[model samples]
Target: MLRNSPLHPLARFLLNIISPLEGNTLSAVKNTQHFVRIIKEQHVTQQDLLVSFDVTSLFTNVPTNKALDVVKKKLSEDESLEHRTSLSLNAIMEMLNMCINTTYFQLDDEFYQQEFGVAMGPITSTQRYIHGRL
Candidate 1:
């Protein structure tokens, strides 16, 4: 269903707009290899501590409204956004709302609409955006 949904293209478009603006935060890891390299380079002793997190219901826990606000603020503050796309921030925000807010899914031949948080598949980076903000 996602392949044919009008929002799919819009999601891609929004991703294109926001992705470049998603400047790397200090906590972000590019991939497992990079993370492993960093870990291997770290000199750990008895005083050093290592911790990990396992978030439950990760995508569903992200507040769509708050995520949108973060995206908006990021876009508005991004100096390179104009160089990336010709679309106004308002236009991008409108499409983002449509993509994030109008998600639906099917289960057991029954259609269900999400009432809160980011949808599971569409607009995957939304989770990252929310995580950085929240």
Candidate 2:
């Protein structure tokens, strides 16, 4: 099971480092309530437009390379990263890439590799990074 996999701990650790940095972004919202409150507080005119998108197959369709690039940029710019963890930025990125790219699954007697996007279940940390960064 993925939960017992060696990379799972590393994914969780990286999530800890990345989550804090992610939540500090201006676009980050605590929840739907927070987002709604912010929208309500805004002063808007008729000319101002509110827009939203319906992203079909959002999780499976996320471009992995683009997500990694964004996370790399965020990690590089984080001044507090050294205090947060001893792992160098390069090391963290490498492990993250390994964890994400190395994902595969077994079905009965068959095994298959995921060619795109992180798996949709269990790996909530990876999902958060993609959702927050993108």
Q: Write the per-residue lDDT of candidate 2 for residues 23-83, one digit (tens) a residue.
A: 7777888888999998999999999999998766566677788989989998999898888
Alpha-carbon deviation at 79 in model 1, angstroms: 1.4
lDDT tens per residue, model 1, 1-134: 17676688878877878997554566677878989987998899999889999777687777888999989998998899999899999999998999988877655465556666777765444443443211
- Which segments of model 1 are wrong by more than 4 Å? 40-48, 122-134
Worst 10 residues of 2 by lDDT: 125-134
**lDDT, residue 27, candidate 2:** 86
Residue 73 lDDT in candidate 2 = 96
Please report the TM-score between candidate 2 and the true structure.
0.79
